[model samples]
Target: MNDLLQTYTFLNQAMQSDSLLCLAQAVCWLDPLWRGYDEDFYHDPDGILSAALVVTRQLFPDLYVDAIDKLRQGATYATVDQLICEGISNTGIPLDNLEYLPYGIPLPAYGVELNDADFYTTHPEVIPILACFGISPEANPYHMTIPDCVYTAAEIIATDLAKRPEEQYQQVAWGLLWLTSATNNSICDWDAELMMEVEPLAWETNDLAFARVMIEEADEIMGDVLTGLYWLTSEPAVMQAMQDNIHRIYKAIQKKGKNNDAPNIRLKWVDLAICPE
Candidate 1:
């Protein structure tokens, strides 16, 4: 477990560097079992390394992929780096071009196609560094909590804040937008219970994050119910589930902040009402 953690830390630093050499080191250090493990490794409970790898792949696509490919082909971790250097020496991609800050979701891009409310329930702000990647919906900065992402990301946020807490917090923002829809007979008659409920729309937020929140002292949002927040079309109801999930992440951050000299958690909800007019 300690070795895995060391690897996870090294991997985090390497990706943060966003440098090619570090990328090589990061990929070269993966455990063989995990190095060549299939995608299901993500579902496994021991996915500490998985979340970091997911972000690292995005940070250094070419070299990371090269190293992983070589590892799968039986190259030792120690040699894969040299093999990659020998194979192709292209200049590394600079992630500085990406903006980690998240912005309002542009529903038009996806056609506001929320026949199912799940369409708008998305959390791209989870990784603020990803904002440097792109603002379009496709470049969503978030990774599914997967039980690992939130904890991992929160740790990153807390630790990173130590160096420049002010800016680190500014870089990443966590936003949750949940969408659940149903066919409405008459738009604004929700009190009459006139709409047909839509099946669960994943859209955003968590399972683990939600669990974290429920256990904490969330007296503020206790009365909160549904969060679908808009009416004209989807009539996204404002429900407790989404609010609860976001709060849970806040609690997790606070729990992790024990290490931070001054842990100031910044939690925000993604308002889906920004939909197309």
Candidate 2:
């Protein structure tokens, strides 16, 4: 169990570096048993490393696929590590000098306490850091009060939106929409009713409408990859209302800029919205 936890810690740091070489190293570490492991291992009940890997793959599909191919060809972890080091050296990101921070460094920034064992259990990828902080596995973040962390995160984002620059509003809006949709996806199994509670908070500002229009315009400019924000919601009424508002606002913006090109927000934000924690 300790070995697995250590590997999870290493992979988590590697992915956060946003380095293709580091990501490839992490993928190689998992290649030995990922496909043959039991369902529970894949689900990663102790941490969210599996989900993080999925997000890493989505972000660097080509690089990840190449790493998978090498794994299939029976590449050892040492070999893969060496290859990653070589790649990092070529890119001037000094592999030898890279110091891995204690996993606890960013926890405070997220306003999360390491003692929240229940939260760590649900979000296993956080376990290593919490362990580093000497937080017991039995401790609870909210003293077992069962606080609504997701809703709280959304509220925080909404509160801060007005303080940001105009150029960042779209990104903030995208983050809000993603938070709502991803939270819904996570709860759709048992607590599906929670989404109804989240709807009003999501639409509190013009963000939902902005996200819808951005997605619609993205589909027109890029492709269908960004067209499914409406479907992310399980409630039909909520989905329809959001879609209607999106169309209304989108049309108004188009008419108001009849001779001008539509504003182009990056399509990558849609991909970011669905990224795993």
> Best TM-score goes to which candidate?
2
lDDT computed for candidate 1: 0.33
Minimal lDDT window, size 10, model 2? 101-110
lDDT of each: 0.33, 0.37
Kindly list the per-residue Cα lDDT of model 2 for residues 70-119, writing each as its tens digit: 65587754454455434433432223311211111110001233334444
Each prediction's TM-score versus the true structure: 0.15, 0.18
Q: Name the best candidate (by lDDT).
A: 2
Off by over 4 Å in 1: 1-52, 80-277
lDDT of 1 by residue, 143-164 (tens): 3212333333434433432343
